[model samples]
Target: MRVIIVGAGEVGRSIASNLEQSHDVVVIDRNPDVVEGLTYSLDVLALQGDGTELGTLRAADVAEASLVIACTDSDESNVVVCGAVKTVSDAFTIARVRRRTLLETWEGSQGAFGVDFMVCMDLLTAQAIFRISGLPATQDVDTFVGGLVRMAEFEIGPDSPVVDTTVQEADRYDSLTFAGVFRGEEMIVATGDTLLKAGDRVVVIGSPGSVTDFADDIVTPSAEETDEIVIVGASEIGFQAAREFEEHGYRPRLIEQDHDRAREVAEALPNTLVMESDATDTEFLAREHVDEADVVIAALDGDEKNLLVSLLAHRLGVDRTIAVIENLEYTELFETVGVDVAINPREETAEEIVRFTRAEQTEKVAMLEHDRAEVIEFEVGPDSVLAGEPIAAAATDLPDDVVIGAISRSGDLMTPRGETVIEPGDHVVVFVDAAVLEDVLEAI
Candidate 1:
């Protein structure tokens, strides 16, 4: 399928790279330099043009495109790009937005901006923070099948007891399936013989309870319990995060430096205690007893500021520190210095938009370890190679590393085994190496 992507920035480049391996990808940017850089860096065709204009869209061959993604920095620009695309072609359009209100508006009226789907970056970051906070020692977390199934990635720490244990030996949960293991640059599909390494990030999928049970067992028994959540800054992501916690029965504390913003958030979030003060004020943090908080999230306006806040909270004795880092390059630096987790909005936006570009049967997708592998949910069609065949018999036709994580059929969950027969219309969640994603998707 021919795919056209607007905005050749980090997020746009990420989407282009993901789709380039399996589909026809074209990237557009107004900056001639950026377009030229992409021309050399990625295999996609790079065009120098404004995405909001019809002439530019036509030059990119929009008529023959199957998907168009509007990911310019400006939300208004992205919506307008999608709107402009609709005037010319019937390609599926997706827009990446930063504001919650815009997302809510589009959600209230599906396809409001000629966009078939919308990915809200800040909102996705907030949701990711909440999910990672709920799980213990998780590197990543995502849900599928209307929340009935959960996929989690946990790094096997050097101190973990299961570091050297094989997948089947450590996986004793009845409903949990070891999906895949990421060891540096290699992705190993989970199997009875696959051994868990200390630095490996292991992916698992199953019932939420079973996944949580597995998480609890792999982490240190003395891991701090998340009883208190402190959010620094009143940025949109921070506000949404506090709201998310409140909706889940958590009365979290929010600290905002701006008086007006703090007051507004306080009014909107009655359950959250909004404190108007500089988050970097060490004296204020001490006075508020921030040292006793279990989890501290830094969502300040600047990446460096968030890093400072996260480091400060870590020094204040917070058990965990999560920071929103805008620049992708700083994610590793922040984590290495002291922050427990670093959330990148661009990466999250790319993950959300790439799912729609997959095969027609793909229902949902969750990228793990920065897209080195993916856990994808897809419906089995009658024409599928796996349909009406035992999983063991069909296994020979699929990529050797593909792991069927979970299956849902007729409102019931099934733990797939060698003898399990895959029928039509069944929603199967599979963990596959990104190298063979197209191969697996085509076979299924």
Candidate 2:
């Protein structure tokens, strides 16, 4: 497959990175520096030019590509690039568009504009945070559904009280099942006598509320004093998020683009300072004393704008810097760019859709590296060879790079060692890298 990516920045680079692994990839950017650096470092073809120009699209050979992605910082540029690509070829086009105003206007006209999919990073990231925060006890929550079910991770801190207890005993505390534990460099499936030591990372799946309560118990056995958090952005979604932060006792300082809008938002939200200034202005951020804040949440409506503000916060050395990204395509770039957290609402929403679509075929599914790698969950059927076999026995049949995470039979969860038996009707979770997903599925 051939893929053409526009915008060599974080989101563009991320899309290129994923597609390049399995396809013929080419990237075009107006900035020569970004093109040279990313292309050389990533070993993908980079062309220097404007994506919206037909000549540039032809130079990149977009006509032969199966997929074309417009990831430029400017929504207008992305739309124009997609329009030009579609005019030249019948390939699928995905555009990164971050403005709510555009969404309200475009409503259902994106197809007419030649865009197959539109990514809104701010709304997506905010939705991700909101979905995770719904399970407040869980340190990190990755939901396969919008909210129907969740996979939550919890850190066993020093004061977790159950730190030294066995997995079985710990399971009795809350009704949540102990799926797996990450200890140091090893992954262990939970067992009756498996000891839960401090610093052990536990994975669990359950309803959102129950998961949050369970996480709260594991992370902070005792009540924790809420810390202050500063959120920058006064957009509608930003205002909604400010309410959530304030409700948690966070000292929130919201900055808007205009004075009148700021005053109006301030009138609606008490105990929150709503001032007027662009988040990209470092002087305004520092003058507002955002540098001293415990955590800075950048909920700007634009991906590039949020990125710039996030970098500023990082440069200023904030304890935490979280940016709202709607584009699921750029998720990996967050890690590569050293951004603490990249939240994508569309990615989260799309995940929910994909999970719903594949719920019956697999026990569970997790999209890794921006949906490039698919983690599948399966239950051993009554007649499958996996039934009644030990983990070691299954290991011999399974190919390399496949890890059997956990087993649950008759509501009892067990960490499978090499000797552990997989009885019929057992539910199991497996981590399958993208390269071997098909073989892994066939083996299970």
Candidate 3:
């Protein structure tokens, strides 16, 4: 597929990097330096021009493109680019916008801006954080198969019950499968004999309940109750997080520095406590007993402020800290500085958009091991290579780095064994190393 990406920002670059491996990708940016950098770093075509301009789109050959994604920082620019692409091409258009109001308008008008799909970064980031909060000790969480299956990453601590056990010994959950283990920099395709260590980051795929149970058993248990969620900043991200938590029976306290914004959010969310105060103020945090909160989410607008709030919360003895970082480059830095989890809105939005560009057989895709591996959910078609064959027979043809995590048939989720038969219409979850993604796709 030929894909044209507008704006060479973090999200645009990420989308291009992910797509260029399997599709033709062209990236456009107004700045020459960004275009030069992209050309030097990524395997995609980089063009220097304004995406909203007609001449630029024509020069980029939008008419023959299969997909066009507009991800400029300005919502208006992105919408205009998508609309312009639609005027010239029959390609599917995806617009990345930060404002929920714009998304709602487009949805209500049935893609008025010519956007076939829209990604709201703030909402996606908030949803990710909410999911992580619900699952104990999970760094990331993604759902697939209509929410019937889940993929989660958990970091094992020294005190974890499953730290010293082999993968087979720790396979106590009936509906869960140990997908892979990331030990420092190496990703190991987990087998029955794979030894789980204290610092290994393990990825698992299974039903939601089973994954949660496995995570709780493999990671050090937190005494923090699920209901005690504290959100710093009544910004859009914070408000969305509060709304999601409230829907899940959690009464979260939202703190905003602005008095009027706090009042507005309070009115909109009756279940949340809207407090008007500076979260960076130590006295205010102490008075409110923020340390007692189960989770402290730094959803402030600025990355620096969010980092500061996360550090403060951690210093105050908060068990977990989740920071909303706009800059994707700072995700690892935030984690290194003691934040339990760093949510990059741009990265999350890019991943969500890339899922739509995947092969038709792939139901969902989740990035793991810093994009070095992927957990992909695929449905077995009648003509698929694995259909009507036992997993053992197919395992010989599969790549060594790819492991079948779970198989769901007739609403039953199973941790597949070598003798398990893969039939048509079965939902199979596979963990694949990035190096063998294409081979796995071809085999399945």
Q: Highest TM-score: give the candidate number.
A: 3
Q: Which of candidates 2 and 3 reaches a greater lDDT?
A: 3
**In model 1, what is the error at residue 401, expressed in angstroms?**
1.9
Best of the two (1, 2) by TM-score: 1
Where does model 1 exceed 4 Å of error? 108-111
Tell me model 3's lDDT, rounded to 2 decimals: 0.88
Question: What do the candidate models score in CA lDDT, each in turn?
Answer: 0.90, 0.67, 0.88
Error of 1 at 397 (Å): 0.9
lDDT of 1 by residue, 42-67 (tens): 89999998999999999999999989
Q: Between candidates 1 and 3, which one is better according to TM-score?
A: 3
Q: How far is each candidate from the true structure, as Cα RMSD in Å?
A: 2.0, 7.6, 1.5
Error of model 1, residue 323, in angstroms: 1.2
Sorted by TM-score (best first), the order is 3, 1, 2
The number of the candidate with the highest lDDT is 1
Over 4 Å off, model 3: 221-225
